[model samples]
Target chain A: EDQVTQSPEALRLQEGESSSLNCSYTVSGLRGLFWYRQDPGKGPEFLFTLYSAGEEKEKERLKATLTKKESFLHITAPKPEDSATYLCAVQVGGGKLIFGQGTELSVKP
Target chain B: DTAVSQTPKYLVTQMGNDKSIKCEQNLGHDTMYWYKQDSKKFLKIMFSYNNKELIINETVPNRFSPKSPDKAHLNLHINSLELGDSAVYFCASSQQRQKGEKLFFGSGTQLSVL
Candidate 1:
């Protein structure tokens, strides 16, 4: 069965703290991996898309790196406003995205 | 202007009642989708339409139906709503049905079944 799992279900960090969220997957015919940021009571916002191993993308304080079996979303000196649930999804055949349970991060100022 | 939008930000109802959630996207995208987020905040895809044609339909209940009246509009209707149906339903769109395309989502509709 194809599956995606994210580690650290919940995280509390002080402002300027750094951390990394993990998303491990086991699936067949992997097409892409995606990252999204979702706030409370709102829909998810697009962040980045990784197509293959060793691919990396960065925006602001967030950087996403992908490997053969897992992906990491590294937060460098996060701020309060940067606190949100980060979601990871893997695209398989037919463009279907299998999502993992998101990691909720709370950054206190 | 909002790129993608859904109606009824919140819907509270009793079990067995039927309701509909409407969605529209102005991004000129060729594809639209419906995703459900449960209490654990795990998102799962329900249905997807490309240019008003159903392309992907997951193993969802038959009581749930998705209608795409046009290329830009997709609506979800639930019949005989159950208590387990309470969740946030999100409407999303993308440029195409090809791989590696990022989706643009709307402010989800929170559904509560009492």
Candidate 2:
């Protein structure tokens, strides 16, 4: 079974704190890895898309990197508005997306 | 302008009631999808339709049915709603299956079953 697991289910970080969230996956065939930020009561907002191993993408204070079996979402000097659940998902065959449980991040000022 | 949108931002109903949540995309995309996020915040794809063709159905219960009237519209109808069905439902769309474009998601609809 293709599985995606996100570690540190929840984290509390002070403003300006930098940390990384881990997502490990095992799939039959990996096509793409995606990162999304979701606020309370809202759907996920697309962040970055990594296609192959050693691929990396960045947006503001967020950077996403993918490896052969894992992906990392690195947050740098996160602001309070950046407090949201970060979701990691992968695409297998036929565009089927398998998502991880998500890492809830809280940034306090 | 919203690229993707879902109707009824919040729904509260009793068990056994049937309800329909509608979704529409204005991105000129050819594929639409429905995803369910449970209380634990696990997002899972329930159905995917491409140009009105059923492409992916993830072993969801028969009570959960997705209908795509066209390339831009996809509706999910749940029969005999149960408490466990209460969750945040999201509607998303992409450019195409072969391209595997990134999805544009709606704000979401919260369903509460009593």
lDDT per residue (tens digit) for residues A3-39 in model 1: 9999899999999999999999999988899999999
What is the Cα-based lDDT of residue A61 in candidate 2? 95
lDDT of 1 by residue, B16-73 (tens): 9999999999999999999999999999999999989999999999999999999999
Q: Which ten residues in a row have the lowest lDDT in candidate 2 chain A?
A: A89-98
RMSD of candidate 2 to the truth, in angstroms, is 1.0
DockQ of each: 0.89, 0.71
CA lDDT, every model vs. true structure: 0.96, 0.92
CAPRI quality of model 2 = medium
Q: How much TM-score does chain B earn in each model?
A: 0.98, 0.97
**Per-residue alpha-carbon lDDT of candidate 2 for residues B37-63, written as tens digits (9 for 90 to 100):** 998999999999999999999989999
| Interface CA root-mean-square deviation for model 2 | 1.3
TM-scores for all candidates? 0.99, 0.97
Candidate 2, residue A10: how far the Cα is off, in Å: 0.8
